[model samples]
Target: MTRPIAGWLSDMDGVLVHENQALPGAAEFIRALRDHGRPFLILTNNSIYTPRDLRARLSATGLDVPEDAIWTSALATAQFLTDQEPGGSAYVIGEAGLTTALDEAGYTLTAAEPDFVVLGETRTYSFEAITQAIRLIQGGARFIATNPDVTGPSADGDLPATGAVAAMITAATRREPYFVGKPNPMMIRSALNRIDAHSETTVMVGDRMDTDVVSGIEAGLRTFLVLTGSTRREDIARFPFRPSEIVDSIADLVDRVGTPA
Candidate 1:
């Protein structure tokens, strides 16, 4: 087996839980890692909630993750916008979480003649909103998005995510968005910087080959693909990207690492 990783970066939705419910062995795996003193952080493309808000929700679900240990696309997006256009006004197409993050980062969210057009997942997306966003982009607003995840797991089923909205805007305005979430090295860099982990010693654990695996490869970290979410065994042959390790789930991660702590 390969050497055990020194640090870990994991995706949340498909790897650990689905629809607010913790998956089998997820908590145990995390506890084992914690008991062994391994440093790990949850990296998620979902920008619907801040780290603190997610932490509370996870805690309520019995996950016991700390606020600082959670990294969301929202935080990364906020940071990216703040760096690119500090204190600039933006027309936001997302949820309360996206707005709150931008507010916290000192960005001015607006609806009219904004300097930038930021897009994310919205449950209430309407035709009028899309038309307005298209107009804004055409009228010289910078296009930005949290991530390119096409869909998210919901209780009812997979629902359109921020990527869908981003795609619509891209198609309408004929402009590509500056993405700030997973598969982008910026998110990985932010996580690594926060935990002070070297790329050589870090392992990225997630379920998707296109996003998680690709992101890890780009970030120069070992990648582990879990079969608990998006990628399935039958779909492996169809995947263009590859991971360094493949496991049944995060539950089996401890076994792959060797004897349990």
Candidate 2:
């Protein structure tokens, strides 16, 4: 028999909403979690927006996830740094999300002899910033990235994300960055810790097999792959691991929000 799921961690983009639009059954799923009084968190690998900013964006899409109920790569990265090097300084190359997280975590942002060179998502990737990051990493600063996602979804198309830039920096400095987001399992563990939930009684819902499913498995959580996102049915066979459950979308699991698997 399967254990009853007491907590939930779900991805934001492919699982809930896509490109300013809410996917099918998304609203109902959120409501069901609320109705059951479940501890739930919406997770995203994008480190481009703060949790408050993400909440507002989801609100516009008709999903009413709270700011506290949302977790991002930015937060995970900051938390990881806090654990690794408390009160350490960093040189950042991202937008408000990454910078704000580091700042709130009591990290001083600087360009001179920083402890780490942090990379994240930005609408615009400046050549000057990358150059500085390359030089900083070469100068003995450790390289750290929010996530390993190479590309992000845009209405226009896929855009180069943190991983691509990390690769560039690695090539220039010969130092690979330690990723702190999905697929790393550290991010999953951090999210579980945040909710005070045991991985044995929690489920991870996501649209991607590589990041979401893999991380959930590594973190000892049941995994659910929703087809409403970036992954397709055929894509499953390509991965060495598999999700515990596969659903058409968030709607299919609405009734099982607080029930046994």
Best by lDDT: 2
- Estimate, for each residue in 112-215, the C-alpha lDDT of model 1 and write its tens digit: 78989988777788888889989999999999898998887767988988888788888988999989898898899888877888888888998988889889
| Residue 122 shift from truth in candidate 2, angstroms | 0.5
Task: Name the regions of candidate 2 deviating beyond 4 angstroms.
Answer: none
The CA lDDT of each predicted structure is 0.84, 0.94
Q: Model 1 clash pairs?
A: none
Q: Give the TM-score of candidate 2.
A: 0.98
73-135 per-residue lDDT for model 2 (tens digits)? 999999999999999999999999999999999999999899999999998999999999999
| Residue 67, model 1: Cα distance from true site in angstroms | 1.0
- Each candidate's number of clashing pairs is 0, 0
lDDT, candidate 2, at 105 = 100
Ten contiguous residues with the weakest lDDT in model 2: 252-261
**lDDT, candidate 1, at 167:** 86
